[model samples]
Target: MRFRPLRSTPTSSPTLAMVAEPPADMRAVVIDRTGPPEVLHEASSPVPRPVMTELLVRVVAAGINPIDAKTRSGKGLSQAIAGYPAVLGFDFSGVVVQSPYESHPFPAGTEVFGMLPFPRTGGSYAEYAVVPTLSVARKPTSLSHVEAAGVPLAALTAWGLVVETAHAHEGQRMLIHAGSGGVGHFAVQLANYFGAHVTATGSARNASWLRELGATTVIDYTSTRFEDVVADVDVVIDLVGNVHSDTGTRSLGVIRPGGLYIVVPTHSFPGYAEAAAEAGVRTTGYRVVPDGSALATVGRLLDSGAIQVFVDRVFDLAEAADAHALLEEGHTRGKIVLRVSDD
Candidate 1:
């Protein structure tokens, strides 16, 4: 509910002269109260300005994730931290229009993509987003805005679990749930790239696609119980938390002694640790944070085709409610993105 001026005093960048003044008000998908996807509606709000160490970006595309919907429904982290009349989006790819601090690495007009601060106000579901400089990295040239928008949050979750937290390496057996979903697709690819033998769970229809994303084995969760067939796994990345089934607790049985069960859900049921202890395995809940350096590494990998981003569908910004509805169906093959503006 605070507003800052869109245009600050000109910085040293020569491109500043070419940067146009932002509009007084811009279209944003805002949630005034918690409910279903219909609660998210397009509204007009003041164009947010960059403050110290922040970059004001003109968003070209934004990525939709389950958290956005959970937040809108007042069921997740957003319910605790988000103020009413808040914009609900985290991942974005855009061009920087203004940088307010001298130490900011990106100049005016830099094409950048990254996740905003999680469990906080990102306001990325808008025409313009003001983000901290350290949270963004240069966009990958090989990807379009929509493709780049899909990478940050999902890729970061995968990277944080496999590379940073679990330290999965060659010859390790890693199991990823929801392998065809946004984060799962990225986790499968990144784990394989890091030399781990990856197993992923999804429907039979997604088996070949999951394999192409580096899933060595794709378990059809609809027909098979993962714990029954999969055992002695070094790491289990549980994106499908303990919501419908005992996924978190059952995953403990598959992990080998001293192996890790990284829960990726924002919230979990009680006694996960006790179950892990009973199985002589370790358990930790993982949350992705904003890291420009890590995102830069991801960008390099994306540009080199070492990792690929899969976009299942693209919706216009006005259709943001529809996007959330589709994501809630919980069976998207990859990521769904909202095209905010043209490049």
Candidate 2:
């Protein structure tokens, strides 16, 4: 099946006076009951139409994140906002199919990629998605649909912490945990790009690769305790959370006084702030927001090769359960994406 674009000519008068009938149904991954990866299965649903300031997107590829798996298992933020039989996914690259407004920045057939509003039903794991114009941006011309799809959510999260929250700058010391994972890798690069001295923690095997991504110091978490070897750091971006023995709390021991520790966890872990308070440091839990403008700036970085997206694997849409299983393992080197269609 192929999705064709809709085109419109400029006119002073409104072209679409009434809502158009969307497709009867479209293929997607739907969860009837939250449980395990088995709960995520391929199904069909009515295609969503562009309403008000929205645009209907023909999704070419969808990116997989740890949150997708958590939500599938009834443990993530989406549990509260998503109804049963919900389509689970957030990041996607696709073409604009129907535009409801003339003032929409992208016209019909414009290729775009973005992370949909998180903790909500994005329905990106489908052939079609309805997204607000403010949440979409033109895909980076230099990246394939698969690559662009791998970016949005993870990249934006990294950008939010490093640039927006931390305000990391030249000569500042920044430490990032799980430096080889999706968001960690990007945070390392972005912090480095902003001229901070970068330190990262990962397996010994990924030490060289993390260094290549701009980490001046790569600590093998298995062989050395990062808190023991690294100190007086300005920022600590903790992606590991409390998974491996109170990583969030232990990270507080490494930051200098007045430094910031940003926690990127789907669920809140206790004692993060208390530990930081004792250490005379700041702590914050960050959730990524949909920002088309910030994503566009990231697209420019991708186009210029200042930053690179590492797609660890790509799964077919039919194998979304398998993708979820892999992501749940929690050791992917980079992003895992689902190829929805050929661009």
Per-candidate Cα lDDT values, in order, are: 0.88, 0.87
Clashes within 3 Å, all models in order:
0, 0
What's the TM for model 2? 0.92
Off by over 4 Å in 1: 1-18, 101-104
| lDDT tens digits, residue span 228-331, model 2 | 88988989999988865677877888888899999887554577778788889999999887899999999999999999999999999999999999998877
Question: Could you tell me which 10 consecutive residues in candidate 2 have the lowest summed lDDT?
Answer: 13-22
Scored by Cα lDDT, where does model 1 land? 0.88
Candidate 2 backbone collisions, by pair: none
Clashing pairs in 1: none
Tens digits of per-residue lDDT, candidate 1, 1-343, equal: 9998698676565544226788899998888888999988889988986666778899999999888888788787664664668888899999988887434578788899997764455568999998888889999999999999999999988889889997989999999988899999999999999999999999998999999989889999999999888899999999987878888888988898999988887666477778788889988988788898999999999999999999999999999999999999888988999999988
Candidate 2 segments exceeding 4 Å error: 1-22
